[model samples]
Target: MPALKSVTDATFVDEVLLAAGPVLVDFWAPWCRPCRAVSPVVEQFAARNRGKITVVKLNADENRETTGTYGVKTIPTLMLFRSCREVSSIVGAPSRKALEAKLREML
Candidate 1:
């Protein structure tokens, strides 16, 4: 699997907003069971679509600024960004097939 990078509030702009292509930001927290459950699926999706998209993980507990700015009320939020704006989002732990289908449709 491709290594998923970690993003912080300080790096959010350079990493996601100004990225050359689409970015998949996985907003999660370490203590959140749902977040842990979906992590592998997210990583696998990233690996399969490596060159087509950039995937990053943002810890909701650690990055309050970006989390608040994005209004991420729930853990395991998957946000897709293109041209510095969010185009799609998934709010919870979805099955691999479900996640893939949703992302495929968006991409």
Candidate 2:
């Protein structure tokens, strides 16, 4: 199963921005309760939709520059990128059903 990949400021450009398929970047922090709450859904989606898109997690605490650049002011923000540009986003912890709905519209 494809797993959720961890990203940092150093690799954000190449890993998410320049990626071929749509990249879902989950901006979160280790200490954020809501961030932890949504992690399982993100992981399952990552494995199930492995070929459809790229799922990555960026720890806002460790990757301050990238988080600031992306305008991620909230924890558990999920941003979708295509062709090096951001196309859509989800802020806060959402239900798996809700997240799936958003993914459908974006994908």
Candidate 3:
């Protein structure tokens, strides 16, 4: 199973931005119910798109710089990045199909 990695400010560049492939960054926090609810979906999406995309999660509370830079005002915000540039964003809990479609397009 492909597991969604938890990234911090320390690893943001090496793990997500500078990675070899496209990435889906989930900006979330422990207190967010929607974030918790979509965790499984993101995990499964990561598993299915293992080679084509990378899935990661960042805690908004801990990574203020990244959060503010990305303009993430809500919990459970998902940002799609390629070549170190953000291409798209999805807020809230999206269906697996919806998430996959976005990732697939990016890949």
Candidate 4:
């Protein structure tokens, strides 16, 4: 299984922006219920798409620069990036199927 990597403002650029494949970044905070609720889906997606995509989790509370750069005003925001460019985003708690479908489309 592909484990989810924790990303901070310091590593965001190298981990997500410069990655070779599509990146699914989950912008969340520990205190957020919705963020926690959607975490499993993100993890499963990561494991399933292991070789095809890179999955990262960014704590919005701790990563101010990253949260600000992405203009993420909401918790549990999911951004899909390819070649360092954001291609799609799903806000709120999306199901595993929905997220997988999006990743499939990107792949």
Best by TM-score: 1
Model 4 Cα lDDT, one tens digit per residue, 51-102: 9888899989999998998899988898898888898898887676786676
Instruction: Write down the TM-score for model 1.
Output: 0.95
Instruction: lDDT for model 4, please.
Output: 0.85
Displacement of residue 81 (Cα, Å) in model 1 is 0.6
Q: Which residue runs of candidate 2 sit more than 4 Å off their true CA positions?
A: 1-3
lDDT of 3 by residue, 3-88 (tens): 56789988998987898888899999999988998888778778877788888999999999889888999989889888888988
> Candidate 3 or 4, higher TM-score?
4
Clashes of 2: 0
**Global CA lDDT computed for model 2:** 0.87
Model 3 lDDT, residue 57, Cα: 90
Query: lDDT (CA) for every model shown?
Result: 0.92, 0.87, 0.84, 0.85
RMSD to native for every prediction?
A: 1.0, 1.4, 1.8, 1.7
lDDT for each residue of candidate 1 in 1-107, tens digit (9 for 90 to 100)? 65589999999999999999999999999899999888988888888888999999999999999999999999899999999999999999878889778878767
Superior by lDDT: candidate 1 or candidate 3: 1
Q: Highest lDDT: which candidate?
A: 1
- Mark the regions of model 1 whose C-alpha exceeds 4 Å error after superposition: none
> Which runs in model 4 stand beyond 4 Å of their true positions?
1-3, 95-97
| Model 1 backbone overlap count | 0
lDDT of 2 by residue, 1-107 (tens): 55478989999999999898899999988899989888888887778777998889999989899988888898889999999899899999877788777767766
